[model samples]
Target: MKLTASAKLVYNFTGPTEVIGLIQASHSGDQTILSEELILSPDAALVEDEDVRGDRRFRTCLSTETSIVYTATVDNGMRSLLPRSGRQHLWNELPPEALAYLLPSRFCPSDSFQRFAQREFGSAGDGVSRVMSILEWIAAEVDYVAGVSTPESSAAHTFTVRAGVCRDFTHLGITFCRALSIPARAVSAYSLDVQPPDFHAVMEVYLENAWWLVDPTRLAPIEGIIRIAHGRDAADTAFLTTDKACTVVSQTVQVSRVDTAS
Candidate 1:
């Protein structure tokens, strides 16, 4: 499927603030960027970089006020796949790159949840089955409340409250997976089905020697999710980060399907 994603952000800064933005659709093997445009008001010099995972980040310095607009046309060729019922990889069998995700991170404290995870999902069978069980438990137990969580909220808080937004859901899922010795990471994306159209957060599990996208909130389909940035938690995948204090004046995000057939 083809998707058009866009975001507009306006911020008021007290002084010159260094900012990093990760609002562009990622270019990966499954997704092709056909066309893209980025507009920075006042046109400051920008530096762009891409991580090993294909997450793109743009850095700049802003004074007073700033407005950023970005648009992209992406051909997402990712297809939904059935869950693999394969055996879970042992610690020694895991790739060196997957080791980091298996450990606890800022928002996803896998170490703290190890006892709870084992008690709740220990008998769920293989890694994939346990992940499915985890998703089911989240869907049945958690409430999708937006304001219930703050930026500082973590998986432990969400587990206590039993409610949160997509970021919380993803964090909790990653926590559970990591607790069970599975490699999981948080993903930020532009999803076509997210209500109120915004930058969406999802979780990716390293299973069958590949990363598979999963949405515990069930707000968007995996196939409709366009990857932006991914990391251990929201701290790494935030769309905008400012070094100095700044107030958000306005922000809007939109993702829509584009029909290719005439």
Candidate 2:
């Protein structure tokens, strides 16, 4: 599938502030970046870096006010549908890198949810079955209320309130997966179907020696998700981070499907 994604951000910085932005689609084996453009108002110098996990980061300094615009067209060739069944690796069998996702993080306190996860999903079997069960439970139990959660909300908080947006949903899913000893991480992406057209949050789980994308909110199809960045939790995948306090003046995001021949 071909997808076109874009974002516009306007901010006011009270003082000199360092900013890191992660709003670009990832360059990976499964996706081909056919065309892209990034514009910074007032033409400030920018530094680009790619992390070990392939997440691209753009660093720049802002004073007074600034605006950022990024747009990209990509051909995502990877399969969107996950397999019905896959073997769940025991902790001892997981690869070294996958081990990190099986632990707790700032927003995904997997350590605190072990007993709850086991009691709720212990009989869900393993691998994809367990993952599907978790998604179903979240869908059935949680309410997708937008203003009910804040940046500091964690999986435990969401579990307590049974309400949150995509970020909270992903955090809760990751926490539950890790609590069950399945490696899972948070994913930030652009999806064609997200209401209000904003950056979307999802989860990726390690199964059958690979990471599979899962959207607990079920707002967007997996095939239409264009991954931007992924990490232990929302703390790592945030679109914008500033060294000093900054006010968001305005922001907009849009994603749509493009004709393959176009």
RMSD of 1: 1.1
Tens-digit lDDT track for model 1 on 69-101? 999998877565537685678888888988999
Candidate 2 lDDT tens digits, 222-262 = 88988899999999999999999999999999999997573
**Poorly placed runs, candidate 2 (over 4 Å):** none
TM, every model: 0.97, 0.97
lDDT of each: 0.90, 0.92
Residue pairs in collision within model 1 = none
Candidate 2 clashes between residue pairs 3 or more apart in a chain or in different chains: none
Global local distance difference test of model 1 = 0.90
Q: Judge candidate 1 at residue 202 and give its lDDT.
A: 95
- Clash totals for all candidate models: 0, 0
